[model samples]
Target: MPTMTAAQRRDLAKQEFDAFLADCPSRLVLDRISDKWVTLVIASLADGPLRFSELSRQLAGVSQKMLTQTLRTLERDGLVTRTVTASVPVRVDYALTDLGVSLQDTVRHLKTWAESHVPQVREAQEAYDRRAGQEVGA
Candidate 1:
């Protein structure tokens, strides 16, 4: 039997990933990236590297624990890089890797879509609530 090169093996693995399948590994990755915190973190790091404090400030409402988890997950996924500087305060900075940078535009678009369509979504939700209330009262 012939041996497959690294590229060939990677290609084969890529072909095996089907996000539609419930058990597909891609689904896990999709779930991670689809998280609001992940989206915000990626978008925030799009411009340049940011220290932990800066990230927390930029992503208001994200708890310290949640932000820490999100950064760890992003780092594990190869999307972000964490650099710890040997300074007085031991500064830690989070920056997007090339892979993360590649996703910046997509994440930005998702954020934009949510922001731009909030009014329509709110109207839809109000209509749904009214219908639900009427059904319950009927």
Candidate 2:
């Protein structure tokens, strides 16, 4: 009823941000994207479409079940296309969609950041571990 104060406005903004985070599918999306198999499958499609067997070959150490689940998630996100060709063997190919192509820049940036910061993060972890050990010893 009364005019809101600056602190109230800031609180409102923070609340909105928290609500947005809760509403966003970030956890589900990250659960799918952060997976090693999913990243490999998406990267494989970067060049062009590939049949299921081709994808399996390109991505080493991926189980067929894992690959299937990853592809389904990507397709549901509108990031990948799956086509079944009518043939004697009934081949299927997976390719990145236009939306998925737009994600390349983001993925590349993440890769760059990880490469640049991994050593720093490792150093911090080791320092913490050493301090923790000293406290335990004392």
For all candidates, the clash counts are: 0, 0
Candidate 2: residue pairs that collide? none
Instruction: Tell me how far the alpha carbon of residue 114 in candidate 2 is from the true structure, in angstroms, after superposition.
Output: 3.8
Considering summed lDDT, which 10 consecutive residues are worst modelled in model 1?
14-23
- Every model's Cα RMSD, please? 4.2, 4.7
Cα lDDT listed for each candidate: 0.95, 0.83
The deviation in Å at residue 80 for candidate 2 is 0.8
Cα deviation in Å at residue 120, candidate 2? 5.0
Residue 122 error, candidate 2, Å = 4.6
Worst-scoring 10-residue span by lDDT in model 2: 16-25
Q: Candidate 1 at 11: error in angstroms? A: 13
lDDT of 2: 0.83
The best candidate in terms of TM-score: 1
> Please, what are the lDDT tens digits per residue for candidate 2 over residues 1-138?
889999999987777545257664565676667776766777778789999989989888888998888899899999899999999899899999998888766676666787799999999999999999999999
Strongest candidate by lDDT: 1
